[model samples]
Target chain A: MIGEWIRFGITCLLLIAALVGFTAAVIGAYRFGFVMNRLHAAGIGDTLGIFLVICAVSVSSGSFLEAAKAFLIIVFLWFTSPASSHFLSQIEYYTNPHLYRYVDRKIQDGPHSDEKEPE
Target chain B: MSVETAYDYLYTGALIWLSVLILFMLVRSIMGPRITDRLLAINMIGTLVISCIAVLSRLLDESYLIDAALIYAMISFVSVLILAMIYIPVRQTRGKFEKDARKEIRAERGIRGSVTESGSPEYKAGKEAEKPAYEKGNAGLDNGRDTQQDASLQEKGGSRT
Candidate 1:
């Protein structure tokens, strides 16, 4: 009986930690002014928040098959989040004409090579 | 309390909190300033909902719900990819009205032969220092070599510090 209680306590602790991760991600998203900063914040929830939630679920259930399935969700998200982030940033860079305002673009061997780098 | 009873309370509380987070994400999505911001918020919402589904799977002891969460993750990821793909082929202009605004500004100034490159809010904000660079970038874009232009731009990221 005590062992079961201990297990429950662990599961609860993990779930709360996961909730904290999600909360931090949301707060960071709001506090950051730049889209790239916001993306950095959202990544916390994408990777850490979801990982902890699955950890909690697996711990509480204690079934191998269920844990495997839940683990698959994490694996799938881990694979895709970076790809989406890349495409989004590329879109922002290519489409936003005001890009030079937010970020300092160091012109390389392009036609604009003669321009002094913004200090 | 018994173990089952304790687990039930915990799961219920978690579900409540997840619902609240989902609501917050919904508001963020609606208020996001740019397409990327909205998409980012929507992506976060998808992650939160997956957690909710996972918690529900445990609380209800329905094993199939874990499968459901897995499917949801796949769908959310694919949706983001599809949206990104839709934007890749369009002409790399900032806004639809930008070209019109440039023409009007040029006409007002009586610059008949000079080309009017794309303009954005920053241009209107009186930051003309970057206009030359912007024009050069536009020149490359107008050559119809989208892939080569993108490849050259990608090199800039190496020194994005």
Candidate 2:
């Protein structure tokens, strides 16, 4: 019974952490001024938030097949999230006419360029 | 309370919190100024929904919902890719139109000897605005050499405009 209680406590804590991650992601998405910054914020929920939630569920599940399935979801997301983010970033790079205003192009020329560092 | 009951309460609380987060993401999607912003929000929403479904699978003791969550993840990824494929060409045409307009203005200015007026703030700003697109186009060309997908898109964009 003591061991079961400990497991329950750990599961609840993990879920709470996931909830906090999702909350932060949502808030950051809304607060960030630039699309690139917003993408960075949304990525938190995509990777860490879901990973924590799935971990919590798997812990409570206590069955080999269920835990394996939960881990599979994490693996699948880890692979796909970067692909989707890359596509989205490409779309942003091509579509936004004002993108150069937000992003520094001088950085592209090489880190050792003659451009004066911003103070 | 019993361990089972405590677990139930925890799951319910998590579901409520995730639902609220989903709603917030929905608002972000609606308020996004750019198509990419909206698409990003939608992608995040899909992720949140998957987590919700996963939690629901255990909470409701319905093992099959896990399969549904897996399917949802696959569909979400494909949808984003398809949307991107459609969006790129439209943006390319729009960019071409803008570039043509800028060229016409530059030609008119050159005829008026405004090329010597590059010291003016407006001309300087316009040049600054043009630089990024030029750089991006060159970068796209470089990428085109590396990837057939980009090369094909460039070809289609060139043919359309």
Best-matching candidate per TM-score: 2
Residue-wise lDDT of candidate 2 within A1-119, one digit each (tens)? 99999999889899899988888888888877667777888886669998998899898888989888888889999999989998898887677654543334443554344332222
> Under the 3 Å rule for N, CA and C atoms, how many clashes does model 2 have?
0
Q: Which stretch of 10 consecutive residues in model 1 chain A shows the poorest summed lDDT?
A: A110-119
How much does candidate 2 score in TM-score?
A: 0.73
RMSD of each candidate relative to the true structure:
10.6, 9.6
**Model 1 lDDT tens row, A1-119:** 99899889999999999999999989877777677778888886668989999999998888998899889988998998888888877666665655553332434335333232221
* lDDT score of residue A87 within candidate 2: 88
lDDT of 2 by residue, B1-161 (tens): 89878878888888898899888889889988788779998999999999999999888988778888989999999999999887776435555644554455447645543554544567545544544343444454432243334335645765786
Per-residue lDDT for A46 in model 2?
Answer: 69
Instruction: Single out the weakest 10-residue window by summed lDDT for candidate 2 chain A.
Output: A110-119
Docking class of 1: acceptable
Model 1 is docked with a DockQ of 0.40
Name the runs in model 1 displaced over 4 angstroms: A105-119, B90-161
TM-score of chain A of each: 0.82, 0.85
